[model samples]
Target: TYIRHDSKDQFTGLLDKNGVEIYEGDIVKDADSGSYGAVVWSNDKHWGYLFDTRPDYGWSHPVKGFQRNYLEVTGNIHETLLEADNAKT
Candidate 1:
């Protein structure tokens, strides 16, 4: 059987502090700043990978601003929503 991955989920060629691969849609946390956000591609003038802290408002920071070791992959947007909802209760 062939399992096809989503084309939107592209690897960012960087690893988290725990050696976890950081990919698009993967929620990550900054170990030092304690800020969490989703990894996404910036198609605007920046044109690179960025950490979108506010997906609803489009607030984000460039991945190049910090060291890869400062990032920690917590979960992914695809599977973490259920977990997040469960925590709200």
Candidate 2:
């Protein structure tokens, strides 16, 4: 798992187990332009799959796109993000 430190030394990138960056910075805001589903974030403390830019809340949602494969792709990202968060504190 790789952790991206922001200018402030905070967790910036949450990569997957395969070393693919899933959540970077604020997931709700820092999503990639293409393949938006490649990443996602937790809102209401619930993991939301990355769908696309939402016109209503300015955020995307994952539904019918998340499965075991998704977890494999985001394992590293999750661990790294957690580590970064711990380091910050």
Candidate 3:
């Protein structure tokens, strides 16, 4: 039996502001600005980097093109899970 998983993986052939390989599942963060979000793409608007950590946020904004070079990879969603577990102990 072929083990199948979520097929949400896709390469945008792009890199983050900090030279990090911005993959589909990467959770990007702006340390200096205290902002973060997952990377995704859309046919029209392209998730515009930094998915924002708020729902229906009023002041949420996308990472500017110039700011992309300043982004740092804190961790992806998978790694975040491990972090949460480690923090519990």
Best by lDDT: 1
What's model 2's overall lDDT? Answer: 0.41
* Native-referenced Cα lDDT, model 3: 0.58
- Candidate 1, position 81, lDDT: 73
Model 2 Cα lDDT, one tens digit per residue, 1-89: 33443453233244333445444332322223323342444564434545444646555454223232333342334455697999999
lDDT scores of the candidates, listed in order: 0.68, 0.41, 0.58
TM per candidate = 0.66, 0.29, 0.54
lDDT of 3 by residue, 9-80 (tens): 565555676566566656767666667777655334554454654546523345556667766656666666
Show model 2 residue runs off by greater than 4 Å.
1-17, 25-35, 38-40, 57-68, 71-89
Model 3 error, position 18 (Å): 3.8
**In candidate 1, how many Å is residue 14 off?**
0.8
> Which 10-residue span in candidate 3 carries the lowest summed lDDT?
1-10
True-structure Cα RMSD, model 2: 10.0
Q: Show how many residue pairs clash in every candidate, following the order shown.
A: 0, 4, 2
- Give stretches of model 3 more than 4 Å off: 1-8, 42-44, 50-55, 58-65, 82-89
lDDT of 1 by residue, 1-89 (tens): 11123677888777777777777888777787887877777755332334445557666666763567788777778767766899999
